[model samples]
Target: MSEPSRIAALVVAAGRGARAGAGDPKQYRLVGGESVLGRVLALLGAHEAIDRILVVTHPDDGDFYARTTTALAPAAREKLLAPVQGAATRQGSVAAGLARLADGAAPEIVLVHDAARPFLTPDLVSRAIAAAQAHGAAIPGISVVDTIKRVDETGRVVETPPRATLRAVQTPQAFRFAPLAEAHRTAVAAGRDDFTDDGALMEWAGHPVVVFAGEAGNVKLTHPQDFAATGGPETRMITRLATGFDVHAFTVGDHVWLGGVRIPHTRGVLAHSDGDVVLHALTDALLGALAEGDIGTHFPPSDPQWKSASSDRFLAFAAERVRARGGIIDLLDATILAEAPKVGPHREAMREAIARAADIPVSRVSIKATTTEKLGFTGRGEGIAAQAAATIRLPEEDA
Candidate 1:
């Protein structure tokens, strides 16, 4: 059995927020210590099930956003796929985000959220994702709490609309990838660009849109008063953790490639290729992201195509895949275990090797080594093992 790939979170921050009357956009205005968009992105980015993230913003404002929000760090800023000058409407920004996620393949599920709404909880995100997975289109909507009325142009009440059937929707709407994409396409073809949210477009497409309960606290920062009324817990931040492991049996080779650098060894690890356990582990870590199969699924040992192949190539391929999917690798920590070949002497060189392979800075790549006191195959001096953990920075939102 195989694990399903993760859903992608797409945050739309390109809105002008004309009604807010703030000096900056509503999403960029300071709320607590962070901007509204920062809080929203951080909340979504912290979710373990989310894979890629893409934030759609005005082209000119992208750099400004980096300076204002920690949610998109420098590395994450480099991965942004924002199209300059988003559409005049929110749907236009969504279209741009969908295009970015569709670069390689669209995500299985796309969670569309508003940067103006920063109080969304992890539970809300999880609920939206669950409903989307089950119902194809799921939107968070709260039953109308206020009295309702229908008026004509003459300012006379024509009818009192039923509040029971009315619901106010929120952002972080989740949808099955294909259906949502098609809904946008269909809307655009019909020249209907008035939709304020993706869920509305789905509903117009005649797709069944399941509505789940929503929180009033999950309010969008539209007016100055709304901006001052913040909700939810504080200091919700996003962090990424990665783990990697590799093993190699003893071989008669004279040298081994550890972390992309060829290190001198009396007995090299036996494998189909250069037997670079360090790079193999790093590759696996990258693949582990989004649950995208392992290195074996990509480059099979039984295949003649990978014979004597340099493991660094595998690492580069993984990095490229991440980039092609609108993501960037941020930092990595790798550990090697072996009885004989000392890793301490080559730690600096290994760092350089991995940095080059991952196309990141040497400062972001850390390599260390430790022995198991002659315990397992590696401790018995029969083979070498390497493990790695990679921290990747993806776009703040994705389709």
Candidate 2:
């Protein structure tokens, strides 16, 4: 069998991103839970078509790059190459990345990408590669939705162009590696480094460039407000609230567990798992928010794996479940109903514990304690009960 074509991705991330506000850099800013550039890197590195991935960054951005890269999976990490320092302009940054690739056995096709554009999907990458294989130079572009006009330096309307011929281009722009390298060399030799993207450089070299259909939702994060946008209907942010309640009867034990905290008590609760009513209620609340069923549905008492398992793991699992679906936990509030055990002293500790379990800020967790005024099972000191409410945000998708 003939050797398969090797593909690479060069991510340009050298710009100061001064328009994105005063922050670590636009690419390093957090969107959802992951950084912008980190999202692109993970996506490209995990892609089956991309054999290697290189990043170009400003010299001062080394620390930020190192911190953001730590979140990649082992496979993505393995495909990542040492980043190269870039020049002042975006074109120079891409050229620096290309130079690094030239030092090694160059790939057959290369997809030059912007690290600030974090929403490129694997299917889009596949399309870019296919286009590159069929055509020497290709770039993905969306049809222009707004009207186009040409204006002179004097602010006079020069001409109105037909909107049908206009397109808003996006990356990763695909090209044959050797031709692109030659084009960059020619541009450098001619002192013509003003080309914004590789596609334009190819055009200047007299190479025909084709446009492929690009995703409408694949937007680049430019300003601070762009990071707040969920892109489109499929990823629109929606808020949700759910409530959960659990009751556990007192059993024979030295201490009782509530919200992942151990406290001296006359009796322990009775149930499967750790019997922490607070955690159980919080887990159920999170599941309820996702409409994914209660804790019992996920971890049945019928299963032996959950025998005496810590309730922290259960809460953590629910939190991960939210993040896995591109959601975030806004708040988790739990109230303990118990006459004895006095949950006051351990309230702060409980908040900290819940915060750790959910991987959220400590301030976002709230733990309260009260009694039933000596009326119900909790009032009789026979059992402990907890009611929890969770607030979360998730992408709204059509059924």
Candidate 3:
């Protein structure tokens, strides 16, 4: 069988969504428990025909976007490209996306979509792909149910146009990549960002654009009430919990590192790295929660670059790994077993240090200290040990 045509989806999410003023951009607002843009990107990225997913976002929205993407599934996360900054105008943003694609390996077909329209179905996506292949350029549109009018500047009635001749347009607007890119480039050169949509831009460029079936349920969420009607979508989520334990023997030194802070002690710990026992245990716990290998698996003892490296780096790396996989680290709890250095003196410091490394609030971190009562390695003043647990949430399908 011949290979299917390669397709890419360009999501325009730079709009401030001022009309739907609940707070933040409407795209970043939660529809269900997930951000509107997150839902849109997830649906598009999960589609088989969409080989690549590029998003155009406002430059200031980077942090918001990062937080939102943690709700996606792994499959969708894998198809996403690094998002690019969008321009002031929606037309300018589309131009930016086209330009970005043109600089690299472009796809045969590209679909332009609005981030506010979060209920896009896989069937609509598939139909759009087929329509673009058949018609070179096509937009999904539904017939206008109400009578339309051509209005004058005054409130008086002007002309009633036939409803049959008018259609309400929606997005996932598909087109042949090369021609659409050319039209967008021409529009940019003429400094004409007045065209509201790509269809109008194509029409201006003399390209024949066709209309495909559009769903009424795929309504563009504009006003605040529109959000009220949407309690939330049925996006599934699952929580994961994992535990880790680590031990390190003491050697000759003046101090030791525990959690992410250095505490004055009678001796140092022996390891390839700085040997922060508490941090190593917490790092392992986070990786274990994601079913990813332990800290040694990532920063091998054999690797020369990691020699005497700070354990905080390992914890930060593990936390970022969870974020990249579309997961949220709910909490990190650690218990330190040491006899010599009293942990009570620096408990809050350790919590603050660990929280900084994990990019979470200090409230999410708990550090408890206990001694073995002169029994084992930790109690005999021979070494220090720690145990940690990590709780996280990920898309249920991925879990």
Candidate 4:
């Protein structure tokens, strides 16, 4: 009745992240200056449509989270609901998160996510939510890129699973709250502690889940090297800094594009056509000090045809606009913040991408990351947050 109260989100960060081999839990490690949990929360908090947010973390880590994650929006904080006790396993953590939901206010749908996945994108979350609403459950995942192997006790390959049928699942896993709550409760009642993620438990209970394509960049930071591998610091620049930040929320759409690459994500940027916030922010910063309008006025996210155009093209168009305006693009600095795909190792790649796309030297671009310190909307890792700034030189005035 009453449309089941729409949807809600539950983020599970309770894992100690021991496998990352860090002095502290990997979640506490600093990436681009902010902690992992902080980054995750930022993405979740940014989503405007989500009805509520529940963060389930370890009891020991609660105080730290409480102190560090103060950047969250007042409205989001009001809807905030967790940090409850998680079980020894991930499934346990979900149960704990569910238990923390308000007694009678359970959402019609729930999204379960992993805190280790700093690269989680808002588009991915939105897509999963859409799917969950259509079907009973939905998940974001990508087909395996590497060879698959089923190993034996001796650590030898016992069988090779076909790559075509296999998929590496990511979060946030979405499901109808009542069914998910029932599944978790049933699992716990049966002492079925082996479930690794919410999807598995749902499948076991006869729910057919729909899978959507996931971004190649969306990665889980399980090992210490993943941070570096995904676009963390080692590749970061130390001087002549320019920062750009831009955020565009969901409007009606079949999919959204980010980072110049097409992802099967949900909803296009709300601004002008090809709402490429990343490129727009970069362009504005490139010309920001010069007082130029952002990508919106130049490209106008409102135009109908730019409707499904590629954002990379917009960046290129911006580059041409800058050159025609007699400005020589210098160092381009940008950062993409979301709770989805890893961006650190990819920073260099992104630099290369921007450089090649703009026909500028690769050395001139710098891409770095930062979480919200787990304090604001970014802290919840809701919408994708990006900041960029460009250094440029304009022609001398004709006397």
With a 3 Å backbone cut-off (N, CA, C), the pairs that clash in candidate 2 are none
In model 2, where do residues sit more than 4 Å from their true spots? 1-5, 231-324, 327-399
Per-residue accuracy of model 3 over 1-399 as CA lDDT, tens digit each: 545438999999999988886578888877645688987987786688898888999999989998767546556766788888899898989988988876667889999999999988999999999999999999999999888778878867799988887889999999999999999889879889888799999999999999999999899988888877864433456799999999999999999999889999879999899999999999999999999999989999999999999999999999889766666677899999988799988999999899778866576799999989888888889999999999987766577
Better of 3 and 4 by lDDT: 3
Per-model CA lDDT versus the true structure: 0.78, 0.86, 0.87, 0.70
Q: Best TM-score goes to which candidate?
A: 2
- For 1-399, candidate 4 gives per-residue lDDT tens digits of 444446788888888988887576777666553467766776676676687777887878866687546544334455566567777888888888887774666788888888778777778888888889899888888888799889989999999988999888888888989888888889888879899988889998888988887777778888879877754434332222244568866656655455554444544456555656666677667545445566567666567777757667767776666555444566777777665445654566566667656656566777777776676665664466688877765433300
For candidate 1, list the clashing residue pairs, or say none. 9-398, 10-398, 53-397, 54-397, 54-398, 55-397, 244-388
The C-alpha TM-scores of every prediction are 0.57, 0.63, 0.60, 0.59
158-188: candidate 1 lDDT, tens digit per residue = 8888899999999799999888888888999
As a whole number from 0 to 100, the lDDT of residue 306 in candidate 3 is 99
How would you encode candidate 2's per-residue C-alpha lDDT over 1-399 as one tens digit per residue?
544438999999988888878767888877765678888987887688787889998899888998777656546767889999999788788888888898858889999999889999999999999999999899999999898889999989999988899989999999999999999989999998799989999999999999999999899888767876744222456789999999988999888888889888878778788899999999999999999999989899999999999999999999889877888788999999989898889999999788778766666789998989999787888888999999998866510
Q: Number of backbone collisions per candidate, in order?
A: 7, 0, 1, 49
**What's the lDDT of the predicted structure labeled candidate 1?**
0.78
Shift in Å, residue 137, candidate 4: 1.3
